[model samples]
Target chain A: MTVATSDRAPAPAAPDGASRPTPRAPRRRPRRGTVARYAVLCLMVVLLAGPLLWQLSLSLKGAGDTLYERPPRLIPTDPTLTNFTDVLDRVPVLRYVGNSALVALMAVVGNIVGATLAGYALARLRFRGRGIATGVFVAALLVPIETVIVSQFLVVRSLGLTDTLLGVVLPGAVAALNVLLMRNAFAGLPDELEEAAVIDGANAWQRFLRICVPQVTGVITVVAIFAFVGAWNDFLWPLIVLSSEESYTLTVGLNRLRGTFYDDPRLIAAGTVIALIPIITFFVLLQRFFFRGLESGGIKG
Target chain B: MSSSTDLAVRERAAAPRRPRAAGARATHRWRFVPWLMLLPGLAVVITFIVLPFGNTLRLAFTDATLLRPGRWVGLENFERLLGDDRFLTALLNSSLYVVCVVPFMMLLPLVLATLVSRPGRLMGFFRTSIYMPVVMSSVVVGLIWTSMLDRRGLVNETLATFGAIAEPVPFLTDRWLLLFSAMFVTVWMGLGYYMVIYLAALANIDGTLYDAAAMDGAGVVRTFLSVTMPGVRSTMALIGVLSSVAAFRVFGEVYVLTGGTGGVGGRNLTMTMLIQREGTGLQAQTGYAGAISLVMFVVLGALLVVQLWLQQREGRTR
Candidate 1:
């Protein structure tokens, strides 16, 4: 695939001897353009991240502090974690975090295992109805979850999984996007790798497990993060299925906080921050893999 | 060089391999492996997606409720939908939202992607920062923007400070403003997500194309139109369809922003919101909700078909 070549090829080619000597000066006016580009980028960042930063500032403010002060403060003058403490005191913050963690963990495991297996089969193996299976998945990608939510809820209820973390986790367990992404990743691998294994008397499963799956670690990581973040951030489905407080994920829990702490914007902000931290942390830590995976999975697929 | 060498090795290996008998035997034996691998996933999809989807179609004809089994009354629910004022408002609102959001979601991201497509030290940070909102939950985004759009919120405060308005605008309370505000937030949240996709598409365009364009004395707009635009056209079309579908099905953001009441006079009520209200609200019109979902499905299905046709045409021409 072009993605495989573009992702890997450009980095090493940049330092060619012919192009290295005059890097600072080509036909372009480099200094002015660079400054303008940086200026535009900085403005874009501020505009994009400003509200989130404001949310952070709000979370840090004292409860009595008005958010609508004449000139809004980007920084809290009297910074405190009282809102955080208040949110914890008012609600089962730890319990909600635990529930979110469990759901996201289950979703991550389920997506990685399910998507990998199915994707590997779709991409590499010849089987009955392979074309139909691929077609079903591609079609499923277009079916918005919201459109099917009511019947999905009924189906979950029929299965007796309502108000449970499993109810929240089950429907999202095998995202079609992840399956397709994994399939693309597998398809991009050099056929030689698998053929080499096959010629050595490796079974189909053995070749897939040892040789194929290992090569797509990048895509796997991407799928895991997407699944994790998706589960963590999901609101509507979890809201519909999980009715009780104990079973509520962080998103649901935070929504409840909005009702309970409606008068206290600071506490709500604190709850928002709590809900945001984990996925943001995941994104920050795996930022490289996340972007690379998105590039390959998104464009090629 | 290594790929050629590997091809040679593969050819040599295949040439020395056993004849058709063993190959046929192996193929027969391995035929079930793919099915085995696919079973669990297919089971999930069938149970959660396929079954529910079929059931939704079934439920739409009946008067289903949470507490009661449906009694099929064919076309009644759809007929009711035709006269349901809330359903009509929702349809109009949803269409308006799609019209407002889809173009911005498409064009803004393309512009941003082009601007930041070049690699540099800080480009990574810029890309990530812009993308940060996309990674956050819709609930959190809703919360953040809800507060920001408050009468005493930062948005109005900034505007007032600049003397742009005489009074605080009712962003969340006023119907048109609320829709616009929601659209703005949706675009903001989506900018980086779509930009990343565009950037990836941009990476595939050979840099030498730009060099060639420059050699022909094409200015910025000319080069972009001739080279960059054509290069990302398929991706743009894909994003257009995806974003429109998303717009048509918008719920969480509006739900959170309006605190789940569909805002004043149901002015900003989207079709998904109507479905949620019907299925789960006090009246519990589950069958009606199903009918609405079917309508949405039809709309989305039509879009998908158009997109596929466009893609096919693009392929054939190429």
Candidate 2:
């Protein structure tokens, strides 16, 4: 969701030095405001979460259930996992899941290893041309994926890797944003620990691995989550790169279900639920890190 | 909102100014270790991102295809685009998308941020539930809305049941409605994401201002207009720039909603969709697609430039 125009606009950076007589008055608000706020929040929840839950309900509905009820029943008439199994029987969703997992795994590992090494290099191990390397990455941040997406496909095709999972992973393996993000993390670290290690005859690699990497695991986790979510949820690049049915990721494959089961909304709903479950589970488990990164402006969409 | 973090990273990138580097950075190290570390990262970025961008530009000028590398046909692709109705529709659709969608994005998210900014246990649940849509894939988001907006889908059925409409609206089948429906989806998925950004900016505003406003006997609306608006003025502008840029580049919503046909008569294509439609396949017109991509990139860049110009002017005024 973030573009590389990295500078956010002005924030109120005033000093909190006013010695006012009212020393932090009790935080209370009018009842009318609270009531109106809750009313709005409830509407928002219904608007945002309603569609997802509706899909879930539709997916769980039995074959005998009516989908086009005028008021649209919130609960399934006969909840069952038949739609999920039917989706599996109709489409090779497990295979697509495997494809998505492979792409995401490669992206995660590649970003963690590649970004960490380069970030440590840029931040700690000073050398010539460092500025140029950093500039190259900063420039990469400004190039929107939409612009380079087709050219990237052309590049992959030229390499004879089109329609392959590796092709899907190649363009995103070490995203420049993650590299720069990792670099920022390393640069923020205090030099006291690493300096002592350097004096004690530890090499650059050791300093990076034993000391620097562990400390920035917070950012590493952020990178990993973003990479996984991005790789899993990405629709456009994979849609372009992989043409064969066998190479389809979950996202690209789910669209195929629409053509195959256009008449059966239940089946399509089941496919979407299947596509959503893993990411939803991921958010449920790692929501702390996700929200933490979000609030601190660490993760990109 | 994450852009603020980049402000810090940019400061660090300025080099020699960061005091934390004074110690270990000087002690340095092995001769080739740094380059060796950078080799993989730099290689991947240049090969995949940077160099491909150059190729996209180069291909924009040539009559290239997937099979054979054709001769350079300078300006032919762009020139043809002047007469290309698909190109024009795409440009208009994307431009109109930015215009229609950005206002909602600017207002809804800020209101959401203000509501959820208060402290309570339920606030956490509200925030997370609202944000759930942001993490869902565009494929899923599109499917959800597509089903909901189907002729017999929930939205139409409910509208009919409530006597709001005598017939089902052609949300997916009609070109104009498809574009508008896609914009709605864009704003829906993006609402929580921007609200979180605004939450951070709202946090930065001093609590004392609200207190002072209350002490001045101002009502809720008065306090909001005077204190809250000015406090998040720059954030509103930033969201304006971000949302417009994202809206202009929109692909997934319209693509998936129309099931990749670009709606009825293929009149609903966004810029990125146009690029994809023209750029892919064995007989794909790489040149024309590249031209579309170039135009989209230039527009996005212009959006950011306008934002920066506005920020600078606001800074001057302040």
Candidate 2 regions exceeding 4 Å error are A1-29, A299-301, B1-29, B308-318
Error of 1 at A60 (Å): 1.6
Report the TM-score of candidate 2, chain B only.
Answer: 0.88
lDDT by residue for model 1 over A1-301, one digit each (tens)?
A: 2223223322213223232222322345434444555567677888888887888999999755667776787888889998898888889978988998999999999999999999998987654578999988877777777778888888888899989999899988988888888899899997778778655667667777899999999789888887887888888888888888888888877777768887767878888888778878878887786677667655321
In terms of TM-score, the best-performing candidate is: 2
Model 2 chain B: which ten-residue window has the lowest total lDDT? Answer: B1-10
Q: What is the lDDT of residue A10 in candidate 1?
A: 23
Interface RMSD for every prediction, one decimal? 7.0, 8.9
Per-residue accuracy of model 2 over B1-318 as CA lDDT, tens digit each: 112112233335455367533222332334566789999999999999899899989989998887767779999988999999988999999999999999999988988888777544466778888888888899989998999999989899899989999989999998788888999999999998888888888988988998888778777788778888889998899889988988998988999999989977779988999888889878788877888889988998898788779879988987
Clashing pairs in 2: A1-A301
What is the C-alpha lDDT profile of model 2 across A132-152, one tens digit per residue? 999999888888889888888
Question: Would you estimate the TM-scores of all the predictions?
Answer: 0.89, 0.90
TM-score of 1: 0.89
True contacts kept of 1: 0.48
The clash count for each model shown is 0, 1
- Candidate lDDT scores, in order, read 0.79, 0.83
